[model samples]
Structure formats: structure tokens, C-alpha cells
Target: PGLEVSMTMLAVDALLDEVAENRAHIGLAYNPPPHARIAYRASSAQPVVLLLRKDHPLAKRGGPASLNDLQAYPLALMPSTFGIGHVVSMAQVAANVSIRPTLVTNSLSALKRFVTAENFMTLVGEFAAYRELGSEELTTVAVAHPLFESAQARVLVKADRPLAAGPLELLKWIEERMPMFAPVKRPARRKPIR
Candidate 1:
């Protein structure tokens, strides 16, 4: 939460690049797990992934969110500064459709604030919006296909050494509270790109 984090939100591939070079105490924070392993040792974080917002047409699409259905709308997205671009890549593969976001911003808090009456859709970390999702302000959208398997969010210690004192303490805290963590999830199918 402080400067020690260096950078909190980064594109996963770039993060991997850093870890490969022994640059950062890098770990991937993902709602869905990646199939291939990277150059770092891995530990996991529980996830509370949320499919949020209602009346946003996506739910009203009635049947499942088919590729054709997804094509009809411009999505509201977190800016490329955040992982929304990565999320879109994941979604593009899963939904078998390309998405052009109507808007993008990096702020999770801002995204939450903006979704009030907009039909925008976003997949977020479970902890990120637990209160609202629990209160039924949002609902988890079920996808017909699956992408990620068991592993969820990943925590990587820098290559040469291990996570030290304070950071180690934080990791332990996360592990103890793991139940609140949501396992990485995916739609049943990784739709082929068109």
C-alpha cells in the first residue's frame, strides 16, 4: 500500500520479464490463472473474484453471454495502466470476441464509482468489492467456458532472495485469511480468436 510496492498494477507479461531478470519482488495478481509457469517460484493468494453490476445489459442478455452478444456493446474498462487490458485479452479468448472498451481508467475505486447506472462490466478481485457484491449490488456472472485451473493469484519473491521480514509478515497474513480469497476462475471454454 506504500512506496515499497513500487508498482502495484502491471501487465503480467512485463512483470514476468522483470522477474526473469531478477529485478522486482514480482508476483502476479490475477483473477484467472495462467496455464504456463513463469521464471519465478510461486505461491498463491485466495481470490474473491466478482462479476459485477446489474441492469447492465450483460445480465439481461438473457441467455449466456455469447460471442455475438458481447460484440454488441462497448465495455467500460479500467485503463491500460491497470490490468484491464490483460483482463480483456483473457475475455477475448474466453468469449471468442474482440472487445473495444467504451472507456478506460486505472482506478478500481473510480471504476466502482462509475458503474452505478452504467451497463459496463468488469471482473474484479474478490477482496476489491466484497462489501458491495455481498450486499447484492453486484452478481457474479457465470461463463460457459473455463480458462484457469486450480492456481489463482500468484506471489513471487525476487529471484536471488526470499520475501523478507515485513513483506513476509504480510504474506503470512494473506495466507491466514486465504478463505476469503477466491480461486482463479475461467469460463468453461477458451473461445478461439476469430
Candidate 2:
């Protein structure tokens, strides 16, 4: 069969649910539920970074600000349903300081647009803001805290089905390019029931 890929965006729970239902063949996500078989590919030490406009005060003062330092400014945050939200929540508890963002939205584009024009900030994975960061439209400072030390990213495939040659090859190519800090063992293939 000629190879074609379909992509859709969903929150972690919904994404895994679709995978479990065999509605999707592959997914890229962080800390997906363990019930789904996962091929651990790479880890990122700074999964969450504070994103600010290039000339924002914090951006001007900084190289990796602590959560307390971030608390001094207004924030724009994703709702708790997204993975980044959960990470920030954990960091919040660990730091014992409440973060009350001036704006909260699930749309990354909304956060991107708002932060560029306002004195607000938000947290996102480096990949999410890769282009903006490269263009100097935004500056990212890692949240220097133990709770946000590192996060692993993995590829998920359904265990009930054997991966076809095309998809398998694509997966391998992705693994090769991933920013894996160190080698991680691939998930074992599930044996077909006799």
C-alpha cells in the first residue's frame, strides 16, 4: 500500500483514547498513559519554558528564571487539561506560589498572539515556539525548578495490531532524528495470540 499519513490534534487523554480505539495508528505525546504500549524515544530536560515577548522585562533580565521570579509578572496559560498545564501545576505546588495568569486559553496561537502584543507570558515546549524563538519574536527562559526537571516523549502504537512496513520505517526515521539525551530501550512488540 502507498503510504499516507493523517494527523489530528487532541489533548493527551483524547489522543490516547483514539489510539486505544484503533481510530489512529500513531501518536506523538508526552507522558501518555502507561496502559497504551509506548516506544520511549526522547526526553527533554526543559519541557516547559517561560515565553515572553523579545522586549518583555523578564526577557531583558534573564537566563532561566525561577518560578518565584515568574510570579512577579502576569501570565497567559493553557487550561489544566493540556500536558503543559499539568507540568506547571506540579511546579506550582513544588514552589508553593500560586500562578494566576491574566489570560487562559487552550489555543497556542492565541497565547502566541497575545504575548507578542501584551506584557503577558506563557509556558510551552520549546518545539511549540521553535519558529518564533528562532525569529527573535519571543524569548524562552527555562523554569529552574526540580518539579520541571525533565519530561520524556514517546511514540505510541496499538498493541493489538502489527505495524506495517511503511509505518515501521517512518517510525524508525523519526526515532533517528529525535533529540534523545541517551539511548532508551524500545517497547517490546506484543506477540499475536495463537
Clash pairs detected, candidate 2: none
Q: What residue runs in model 1 are displaced by over 4 Å at the alpha carbon?
A: 1-28, 31-52, 60-64, 79-84, 90-96, 148-151, 178-194
- Give the per-residue lDDT of model 2 (tens digit) for 77-99: 88876677777777778777887
TM-score of decoy 1? 0.61
What lDDT does candidate 1 reach at residue 81? 37
What is the per-residue lDDT of model 1 for residues 90-112, given as tens digits with 9 covering 90 to 100?
65776667767666776676667
RMSD of each predicted structure = 10.7, 9.0
**Among these predicted structures, which one has the highest TM-score?**
2
Cα lDDT, model 2, residue 36: 49
Off by over 4 Å in 2: 31-46, 159-161, 178-194
Assess the local accuracy of residue 33 in candidate 2 as a C-alpha lDDT between 0 and 100.
46
